[model samples]
Target chain A: MARQTHTPSTGKLPGVEKCPTGIRGLDEITDGGLPRGRPTLVCGGAGSGKTLLAMEFIVRGIRDYGEPGVFVAFEETADELSRNVSSLGFDLDKLVRRRQLAVDHIRVERSEMEETGEYDLEGLFIRLGTMIDQIGAQRIAIDTVEVLFAGLLNEAILRAELRRLLRWLKDKGVTTIITGEQGEKTLTRHGLEEYVSDCVIFLDHRIVNQIATRRLRVVKYRGSSHGTNEYPTMIDQHGLSVLPISSLGLDYGASTEHVSSGVDRLDAMLGGGGYYRGSSILVSGTAGTGKTSLAAAFIDAACRRGERCLYLVLEEAPAQIIRNMASIGFDLGRWVDKGSLRFHGVRSTLYGLEQHLVTLHKLVSEFHPPTVAVDPITNLMVVGETAEVKSTLTRMIDFLKNQGITALFTSLTEGGGPAEQTEVGVSSLMDTWLLLRNVEMGAERNRLMFILKSRGMAHSNQVREFRLSDQGIQLRDVYVGPSAVLTGAARLVQEARDKAQAVSERESMARRRRELQQEQALTRAQFEALHLKTAALDEELHTLEAEDQTRRVTAAGEQAELARAQGADGNGGLSKKGAKRPADRYARA
Target chain B: MIAKHATSDTELLEEAARKAKHQKYVLRLYVAGMTPRSREALRTVSEICREELAGRCDLEVIDLYKQPTLAHREQIVAVPTLIKKLPLPLRRFIGSMVDKEKLLVGLDLIPRTP
Candidate 1:
């Protein structure tokens, strides 16, 4: 590839000053644009943008290089042609006033007009030649020379006349653009214009699948190199911009500045903090495994550095990623508004991979971003051939490296959970390989983000558990549970079961403590009741003793009197009313 | 481009007068077939020769289709083949007589500025 690079051989080349195509990818296709100062013919249908293209070429030459131009229309008047191309942003009038452009409308009326038998188109040639010299034109466009065929009734004279006109144009050294309406049967009316021009370009406006598409194909470029693929082009107020699908090798010199991947621990693993700038890093993982999250972390880090970043999301839309990343504390939208970041979400099936690459390259070139992130490069396999995708990636990686810009590409591993094989198959070309896998240790499953390879620096291979929380991606080293990969649905299920068991064990322990307290309270209540009964009996005995003392004196006198009453009562026993507890003993005796 | 109309003898005579005056070119409508289109081509060619090329170009009328021997003599393979004979490098144009403007352009008759 290096040997094939375009060597500078100025003198060997006939025409070198490139005519800026004013269309994307067009210059690259034409090997640095058109022949600088030679006539090229563009012929197509009435609405095939011939006039528009011609107008754009002339207008651009006037505006960009200060090279004036002349537009000679043999069909429509100058005003009509200018008005027709107004929507495409071609202002011929202003350029004319600036003495940078000249428009000529050749009107031929056969009625009441007489032509001498011997004649030549010397008059029209002189008119155009004067304008070219007056404006000092570097570009000239003549629309529909076939109109001459229409106005001239004698075919023999018209042919010789046209041949003369073309020769004159060539001798003038004005890089000319000759337009003709395409005939249904031939490329041109006389079918001989192709033999007279240096280059031929075909513009196609086709509707496929209900979508209008404008494409450009170079049928021929005499004595020069050109692309063969049908390139997609867009027509808007700015005229035509061809998509540069062929510039896969646009950039090559890359910088070596390192930036962290937003995870402090991961950064630490990456030799005291991050991957090298302009380096291609591949994050390979399976479904439900945090490949996108890790790539986001890298992108977020670049944004943190105030570096402009572009994210090409081939899998998910910007809105969806922004929403899902909210849990991980990464707000890409804010970075987008700050002008530090931009996210372009494109469908993998929308266009061929080369077109996608060209679009991305154009964006990167135009924006001059310091960092770029392509989420899941593997997704492109759905649209293009595998080999083509790989080549495109290689070219792109080369381009990024040459520019010295940091680039991270995420690739999804094949199904059956994160394995070594991936979809897009670009793992070998990457400068760094960041592998995330499920590791199970103990009863816990953990998903860990690890750097498997960093080409120029020391990197840690420790499988650290990566978690996406409200505060963003966090790595927890203290989780000493089972190390099973816990980044999937199955991990969540097992985790819930483990937590449930822990809660149930605590519930039973609380119930056992409640039962022991109930039994101890019952035994204490019985002992207290017995003590109270004994104290009450003691109090009763003291009261009885006091009563006995008070009645002692009265009893002696009563006993003398009672002796005579007792003898009358006969058999007077101890009164039961005055007996105490001790009387139970006496009764038993 | 409208089809050319028929020519009058006076117009033809007048065209001859012009061809004699200046170093202008002389033209002739040499056509084949008896169809109206062929007749139209012959008549239209003479009329134009009278108006534009009169007193300048000599106008000759040749019917090759009616006289196959003449067509063979001229080596005319296709009908409606207009030939410029007086010029050094004689040229021929072949097509239906439908395009008038094309005819003038082909003949190198239109006034050019360059």
Candidate 2:
């Protein structure tokens, strides 16, 4: 029966066993860390930090994971190794003194020794076994294993001994790290160590454009998944830190809780109180565009909430920041005295990118602040090259995000004040981006604020005038008119013109009302004159009716005497006929 | 003629001086395993030491397989390396030790070839 080999091609199989490296950002890429209880070969050129990495593994294993380690140095003496790494905050001597660690230096001088043997490194095995038993070490670090076989001339014997040693390490059930010198064409000078080890990691130091950068790559990891990309590894006082270039998939949770920007109007301009909790905010602007002022407002708000805040000022001292913020009515000295705010300042040019990152990590772990503000992160570009700066910032942001700390960073722009020109080129990583510009509309320049984008929230699109006064920072609505959005003195002038136009409209309305009143009075006088003429006509009619009645009465009396005479002379018919005939004849005449 | 005579006298004096200073030599032969070449080298070196120096030489043969510590301490890189320790100028010869003349020359026995 043929035995089949289990080899993973692409991704990690669930439940693959591993050991955590305890180094920041390294465990994330390796899923957990190196394969447990297997030998790992680390090959690198001179000054590529292979020895440092190996030593870090041993030291971190003993200090952090409580796994006792043995360091067998072939090229460097134990004392030398300890001295070289004392600055990295590793007390190697103390660990050895406490019996938790062991450092063995194997000295082999080529000019004094002779070999007439069929040997298989049994002597080395015995020595290492004694040390391992002394501390019950679970991890072992061999610095430059190639040095032990430097004087051996037989290739076959050397290869056999190397294979035997690796097998012995595996049988001992100890996780081991072996350092080697990079060969011209092979991963290691011995060329066979890579095959015998379970995992191989390569480190490279390159100088491009007068800038030095150290990078690390995981060449192979048997039976496990690991980040295959070349990650930028930085070594400083804090030892080695590997920045995994590839994003550790989107596994972070977003917070719906909003924190105030400390400026009420600005908060209203943003859809709500402020940015989301545990989000990264970027405030980019030209010089003197009040970028620091905005950052101070954020810090003040965080401190006012009784939350601890850390202000990392890469460009200014803590005293200078406090003094400047005080002039703007943000009395932060009280916060500092109350232990709510802490300030740490470092010149951007004082250290390399890795050292700065290490310092930041150290302070953050010690302070444990809920909110952090990095004033003018753009200044860090001076210490590192473009790629270095980006990788370092990426790792730093990832760390802060994982810690669930609200982060705010300020960047300085040059002539073109648009916020799109993020000089550091990290706009994509920010959750909220606020762009401030110097809107030069009049003889003086006024500060203007615009929200470029706010991920997962609605934000204002109108540009507002950002005002800084003795009271505090304020956001006032700009004068938007037919032509353009006016600000500063231009806004004041536009406002005045609007007021004058309103006054003129009111005066014209009053004049129109007086003319309407005069026209109504003349119409009323004409109506009264017509009423008097109608009353005179009514009186004349009444008087004529009375006269006619009286005439009729008098006539009736005369007629009564004549009628009585007529009646005596003739009958009723003759009176009627005679009266009607005489009347008709008179009417005709 | 006088110059030729002075040359002959100097030659004779040099020979006499070399004969007078014929001290016992201390030699160490280093070999790996018991391979045919290493065995042959051991045999040839011992025979030369017995015949040429006649009990005036001390030859120590070391097999690298048995005692590797000695081999490591001595820093021997190759097999069949014969080290001449006593001579003012230490010399080393690497090979099967079959070339007696070459070995003698390497051991600073050239002037005492008789």
Candidate 3:
């Protein structure tokens, strides 16, 4: 280890005091900066960004830092390098003509020359020495020195020669770097190179599913302390820039007094309208509980209001989220196409968490989006150790805040009880907590969600039934019973019991109606029969009386027909007894 | 949108220089792939140069993709980087080769330049 020591400040007779690496945080990691006058190594494999990184280092030194430099290459010509990094906007030939920089290309080919076993690398030394002195270069980079080992077969001599060259460069009292391709398993093909060099840096390239990740790690530094974790490095037109996740400043961003959550109900539940600008809010819930849909609604709201949004999908693909939430009344795919909504999807385990955090910072910085979101932070945990993930989360949140950007993060909860979930927690960095659970009422199970707590704002505490449909997630007004938050089996049982009870009630009502009808019919029949019998008895009695009177009249008519006929005919007002005979008997019964 | 797109290589550099602020030095560099120590040396030196200078510089970079022969007239022996020209004394940082002390003394950014 290069025991990270401050520069001795020995009043040297040199033309300058110290040279700093323009890369942020690099100076601190190296204690001061690279040694003032030595060549440094930066090596990697195919398409590992070695050439680009070295050029940026030198050109930036000259142009931005006012330090002139000399750039030498054996693989590609200076013109090739220039065209490669044109997008970053660097001019090489002009600097050369102005005597501010010197770039030399040393070509080494297998077919062009034969290497003797005693080769001393004299041409490289002379060319390098000449350029260093000519430009008075403060920083130097040697990209892919592995070719030396390939061109020359004598390892013994090569190691000795390389050691001698490094010592000579060291005697020159300059910070130096030598780059070579990493071996299959070792840090570099010539594994012993680290032992020979003052500082050893390992550059890596890992390809999984065609998304490449380039990283840099300080394997060892002879006189300085460096960040130990593997850091993500990006190469664009600006060349190699390492992402320093640990140094993110959380308290340094500009935050607005007011921030709006896209939805009115969600905002109301969150105290006001979600979080302030430059703040991070985490929305955690179980599967299929509208967590993703809720986030999409927020993104849509932001885009509609002309606030820039970046939606990062770590759990699902962008297309999937768009399609799934399309039914929830979200029109974000249109915004994505219009560029107001930026979507980035990546598997969490594919790269290190630090790298993921770095990429997020890079994108946010580049786009300057007003609102940013990460769907499900759990995936980042899959990428590395728990502590690492936590730190990455902290750093990422800090970075977003420092940028004064509004950020939303969603995480997955294992169970459904809001209280139980609270017990199992992540970093409590959220300003609002929304608890969603499944509650049983009678025989029906409902999705009940509500606001548990919100900082700095008054909110409704009523548990509302959460319903999702074509219109999106809506809070229903009905309350649900507190039945252990109906899970799979309980919900099923409740539904069955409800259906069975309805069936039983219907059957009992039908049986009672049948019994009442039968009793009424029997009473009506008995009353009609009794009335007929009484009428029959009264008719019989009247008939017998009439027969007896007729018999007596017939006997008398035989003796005195004239007298009997006269008497009966005269009695027109016949007795009241006869008139009341049958009628009175029926009335009495 | 990048303004006033310059078509010719020479025109691009001229435009860059003209637009560049005195404190912000606009620079364009051409380099090839990593082959020998020269390329690596150039990579190392430029970063050191950027720091000593601070914000007074701007760099526009281009990679020749291992075809250093295009910049042959510039007498480039290193593949990584070449400072074509600058203010007064012409200087060059060869290869990806970088040394901190050498860079401070060599670039003259500290006590001398100021």
Candidate 4:
């Protein structure tokens, strides 16, 4: 696989030089371009864009690479070819008028002519020579060379002339493209052209899942290496663009610069200012879950920073988007009016997957936007198969990242879980995946946004309630409770109930504190009253004791006076009575 | 009477004469290499052109080996095939012209019996 994907420079090869096709994906797969100065055959079934591819190669040769081209159209008229490619934004008429391009439509009506004997393609050679010389053409396209078989009656002469013509084209030293119709068992209706050409590219238009996808593959490249895989191709206003889905070899540079998501909290949720610049961000959600809102926020942030943004509106009109976003204060119209934002709204069912990719590539290049937002990329699944959608998105993301353009894509999932409703399973390719869900907890469904994955960066793991209010998209705090993440009216009700309960609890606590204060004041007054009662009782007891002591003393004093009178006759008896009274008092005390 | 003459006037007769002149047989025979089938087909077709139409037939023989482009252009899936290219409806016949009766019927030579 590594050897197959490796494409060496053709210039380094000995005798082969490659001229860049100047087409989007063809040059990449061709390892620069078609083998220079060699005829490359492009064969396909009818209406498989063979002639268109041939004409585009010539026009691009002249327009992009400054290489003059001569187109020898064998199937369609020059005027018809010019008109056909005009839709691809290739003004072949103008190029012809400028003499940088020459288209010679060969008419081969078998019924109108008579085949004579012994004639070569000298007439054709002369005409081609004159045209090539006139414009000094470096590239030439022979569209449907098999027409010679129909117009000319002699197979022997026609085969001989065709070989000479191919040799002559090679001799002219001009890179050439020869187109042929697909045959039943042969690569081309006329199998000889493939043998004459150096490279063979086959184009296939097939319907898968009812969606048409055109693919191109390099059947054989003579000397140089090329990707042999079938690359999806698209023709639109910008001509042919081949999408090499698996051709990228993981060599793109990563940008460290970050881009804001506009909503500051959402930016914070991404753990950085926003997503990394040039990273692919996926915002997948159910209907009305603010997927578009988040994408718009990213675009709005990009536009605010004076960077250009391209918004591919697949589901809604620009005015509808503007009006819807206006309700959320996004005001995308201003950015559009200022030329910082561009909206390309197309019905998803209008074109096949290839045409859409081509038009998208053209628009992106023309706008040269620094950021691109595809709203509801899931709608593309309606026009393309799941595998095609995945590959197309993968290629587009790769293209955008290579250009250093920050890309944000929003996908709409069904009513199942995020994993169940993944439309194309492109989340694995994304640098960051944001899953939005409608958390249906109660009668109401709330928007819950989850960062499913964010590669190469630290991102928030919390589920945030995404709100689209009059102030635009805001990432509100998640109502994380016993029941987990809650959102919308349920979250609002739960929050309001919690707030009421807190208020009641605080009021009860204050009331309890006041009751305890009142109880303490009552106890202090009771203690003071009891103390006063005790003091009064003590005072009364003291008075009674003093009265009793004074009575005893007076009685003792009268006895002492009698004893003293008697002691006049007997002093010793009086002295003994005082001593005995003193001893009795001491013993009583 | 005048209207009838106007419908079949000199111009109408001239157109009829031109159509008669254009009634010459235009035939093409496809062959692959110098195979016995290819030589036999060429000889039979040439003999038919010479014997049946004589001066009023134009026949061209194409060998697939020499000019595969013309063979493919004519969409010749099989060799030794004959194609009547002119005189109204185009017709094709496979195999050598050994069955002259079928070849005559295919070429509308019986119409020239008069």
Candidate 5:
């Protein structure tokens, strides 16, 4: 995805010029293709794609760089070579007819030939020169030139002639590629590497655990710095493409833009509306924890924004994924129909790790999508070891990032393994990690999700219950009981219990208010009865006081009358009586 | 037994002689200019044609330097290559052709030993 603008014509280097192969990743690794106008040796074992690589170089040179070439086929005939490479869409015959390419098949049968005396391979030189002049070719490919070793009996002569041939090609000033079969100790069976010393590349096809992977390496490049790492190469219907793993540098531009995650509450949990543009997001969970659903939601959101998206499914077919997503109200089928969403489904066992990576590269480059989703990246582990899968994913992530693409990858963790750990160990490469887990309580399993990490954003750390309903994915706050985090039926039961307790407490308070009112009424009635009794007692006392008053008044009046009736000394006696009566009345009062 | 062996040897010789008389040898010698090796190869082939094949041999010597395209057309990788085109099965010999026995055998004029 690192856009290669440094062509051979525009190379900035001063000393050694280059000839761009026009291959997908070859130019980037070779720092602008093989050394210009020099002989490069491409050696490999049988069926290691040596011939295809050489053929593609010539074909691409003619088609892309406008450099006429000649292909010297020593093993297969011109027709056979043409038929073999036709699948890659390279019409050799058409190129030949147009005088842009020439295919010369050199067939030597040892049984049909007799070597009596000394002979140089000047005839081959004449044939090559004539072909080169026929089309004014600037590039040449001698596919497996070692075939001469099998046909000729004299090794010393063949070796010397091959050396002279390479020197002759160099003197001609044409960029040439000579393929040789891998030898036991040397780089080539015929030791052709000893002759073409400008550049040497090795192609390897290895089958580990029944999965075949092809790798390419630049063994030596004189006066030029080239990638030394073994790059994973793949040959498909589109010809040979080498994946330069180390060519990706951490220098891609980081965008500050944000894209939605589809789930509103989940977006809120991410702090800023959504993820950063061109950032990688990891959604990891155990089985049935809605990892795929979460990824689908993101894809749906991206599609809704009118951005193209690519969904790579390894476990499920495109139709199956669409159908499953439809159950959650995601109309992915419509997006696919609208040409905004592309689904590429392939089984993990269908190819090796490198093949899958190459396929990913091919698809992405072809589709040029802004967003990509790889559902269950852990499924790739079936084809490769853990380290290989990690490396592949690393390259994949780097590629996506270099393209400024926002990618979402879902990882399926083992049932009992720690949900935070990914088997592929790609979490460190993600800009955001969303962990989903299953919490078992009340004899039922419930889904829970929490943001493990989100770089450059303040994300929520609180766990939330994850639900998938007919409407869509929903994130609800987890219920925290006295002992543990409650979910599902357990949370509902606890809520009901709390509500019942509140209701009973309110009812008891109402009963207490009625009882207090009855007690107040009883006290008031008892006091009223006591008041009436006191009033009656007061009336009786008043009546007794009136009777006593009357008695005292009658006694005083009789004393006064007696005092008035007496003569002479009666006045004094009457006065005395009055005083005595007054004294008696005062004593009674 | 010795007499029977001698009679069989004579019969085999007669059969070879009959095949050689009827068989026509069509030969092409590809060379790079008139180098010593090319001239020597031409001389050796002409001598064989005159002595062994007589009137039944047709030999053509091509200089690749003059007609360079023929090298690729004929699929010739070695210089002084003699191609027997008309012996049912084609055969080629590369070198100065100083060894006539090998050339005769390749041209199917003489039966190969073992």
Candidate 6:
């Protein structure tokens, strides 16, 4: 479908040829533009920018397309029209002087005239035809043609003449735009839509929540298909621009490149790298959870890479943000001075949601930055509802993605709820989400960060304690105590207690080893003393054996002598018994 | 029509009426080609000028078809539009000039109240 619209030469449908209006987003939505050589009725209430649209059509046609135009104003004089649009940089007077445009103011006063016989609006035709011929115009605008109804008394003649005028313009082959005031039950006050039937566009200006938003919608197109959504329109210094809520479809290309999240540990947690180059990143946390600091870091990293970065702040001034970031060791002001970072600080309630979106679009186009950061997008919810903010963000994200720009958005999630949930409901649209949380433990609050989800990478699921110091943001592994994840003072206290317990256990093991060595040494000493005693006893026994041997010999000799007196064989037996008796006595001793 | 009683008050009123009638009036009638409405408007305006202000009125009839540029220059939006020029307070009337009374009143030939 995109290819069909972009390549008109090959895929052009058999429909009315289009004349591009040269508007920002109008041509994209209208398929091409209003049907060429046919009248388009633009009807709206006062202050709804009907006249401005018609004037811009003529001016842009003359300037951009080189097609001369004629503007027949029934309400404002030519000078008034010129002066009114000068703010938009359209020099109507100059265009007229160049002979490229012709402005004719048609004034009809009913009180100055008396009708008695039949008449036609041939005089108006001659005037218009003469002007068209004078400028060789290819386009014309008749602003508020309904004023003719009030100026002329005869309705029947006016209606018939109006019909004839439209038909004549069509026959002339000049694309025409006729404006009318809105009516109660009809598209136009005098039903001008009935006459100019080829196309019709409606402009609406409505106020919601005290903010004004202008919208444009194509009500009908006879021979073409057009976008049916009510697109938001804005009239800024440049001109009127229609902002399509979203692109025709989600066909934007996804990039494979990676861009840093500015925090090393964050990059590690996000699967060894950073987010996709053209992806949207959401940093959601409760108040005072350092959402802005994370965004600033990302912007700083982008700037350091020599890529342009746009910082859109809604909650703080640029100077204040720079100062605050400087305290965190991030010199954002240096990037700003180097012209790599641009700060666009605006109050969230400064305008409507649509206006903010338009401003963002304009800024992005003007700067053409490769990276953008919107700090605390939650503040934008103050101006619009959640759905509106979400839609606006979706469009913003889509626009950035189409340009292959990496975007970081900070959202202030209310405390006590799931930190992963973004209140604006844009978490689904983000490709990467990093959640920051504050855990209160042991009378102190400590920040913790974890990658909630990273779309296309391996990420760590461990929750790390987030710390901010004079140096910068630091992420440390949170202590998993026996019962809970300890942080802040509790983690410090637990670490100290564990170290002390280890020290005491080492000291007790050393004392037990010393006691075992002393007991073994005492037992060895006792055994050595007993061996010495046995040695001394053996010496005494040897001495005693020497003496006993002599005594036994004497006894044996006496016994033998006695035995010799009796006989030789009995003496030998007695001597042997005496020797055995002496030996036994020695063993018993 | 005037009452000729010849009283002093009547003579003063007649003198004032004569002066008002002698005032010069310049009128230009713009028409588109020779259409029926343009022809009728031309005829009615000529008769009104001849009968009412004969020598005191100056009338010029312009055809938009011949002088198409004049339609834009004169700011003419309707056919058969008569613009009273030389009068101090210039006035313009549109449509076919068949209603002679209204034309006379617009031309200041008849008192507005009457």
* Candidate 5 per-residue lDDT over residues A1-589, each given as its tens digit: 0012232434566646789999888888888998877889999999999899889899999999999999999999999999999989999999999999999889988888889998989999999999888888888999878889999988888889998998777767778899999989988887888887789999999887788999999999987898999899998888889998833568988998888998999889888689988999999998999999998999999999999999999999999989999999998999999999999999988888999899889999899999999988999998888899999999999999998999999999998888789989999999999999999988999999999999988899899999999899999988887787898888889889989999999999989998998898899899999999999999978886777677667866766676556534556655666657655675566
The digit string of per-residue lDDT tens for model 4 on A1-589 reads 1221133434454645788988888998988999877789998888888888888888888878999999988777778887887777888888989999988877655653433223445446656777788789889998888888886676787787788788777777788899889998988887855456579999998876666778899998888788998887886656678876643777778998889989898788888678999899999988888988888888888888999999999999999999888888888999999999999999888777776777777788789998999888888888876887887877887888888888999988887554534687888778989988887777877788888888888899988888889988878888889966677777788999999999999999999999998888888889889999999999988886787677668766776687776766664666567656755674465
Of the pair 3 and 5, which is ahead by lDDT?
5
Per-residue alpha-carbon lDDT of candidate 2 for residues A425-512, written as tens digits (9 for 90 to 100): 8999999999999988879899999998889888889898999997989999999999998999999999999999999999998888
Q: Which candidate is the best by lDDT?
A: 5
Q: For residues A1-589, write the lDDT of model 6, one tens digit per residue.
A: 1222232323456887787888888888888887777889999888999988888889999889998999989988989998999999999889999999999888877676666666788999998888888888888899978888887788999899999999887777788899999998988888998887778999998888888888899999877888888888898898889987666588888888888888889888887778889999999999888889999889988998999999999999999999999999899998999999999999988888888888888889999999999987888898888888888888888888887889999999987777768989999999999899998888889999988888988889999998887688888999997787899889999889888998999899889988888988999999999999999999988898898778777877777677778876855566777778867886677
Candidate 1 vs candidate 4, TM-score winner = 4
Error of 1 at A110 (Å): 13
True contacts kept of each: 0.00, 0.01, 0.01, 0.00, 0.94, 0.80
TM-score of chain B of 3: 0.50
Better TM-score candidate (1, 3): 1
Error of 3 at B1 (Å): 74
Clashes of each: 75, 17, 172, 6, 0, 0
Evaluation by lDDT, superior candidate among 4 and 5: 5
Looking only at chain B, model 1 earns a TM-score of 0.62
Chain B TM, per prediction: 0.62, 0.76, 0.50, 0.74, 0.82, 0.79
> Could you tell me how far off, in angstroms, the CA of residue A268 lies in candidate 2 after the best superposition?
1.6
Model 4 accuracy (lDDT, Cα): 0.79
- In Å, residue A234's CA in model 3 sits off its true spot by 3.0
| Model 4 stretches with alpha carbons more than 4 Å out | A1-15, A59-69, A78-103, A112-123, A126-137, A244-247, A417-421, A456-458, A478-500, A529-589, B1-114
Q: Estimate each model's TM-score.
A: 0.58, 0.74, 0.57, 0.74, 0.86, 0.87
| Regions more than 4 Å wrong, model 2 | A1-21, A64-67, A111-126, A133-136, A149-160, A190-192, A208-211, A236-238, A244-247, A312-314, A342-370, A374-405, A411-431, A518-589, B1-114
**Candidate 1 global lDDT:** 0.69
Q: Each prediction's Cα lDDT score?
A: 0.69, 0.79, 0.63, 0.79, 0.89, 0.86
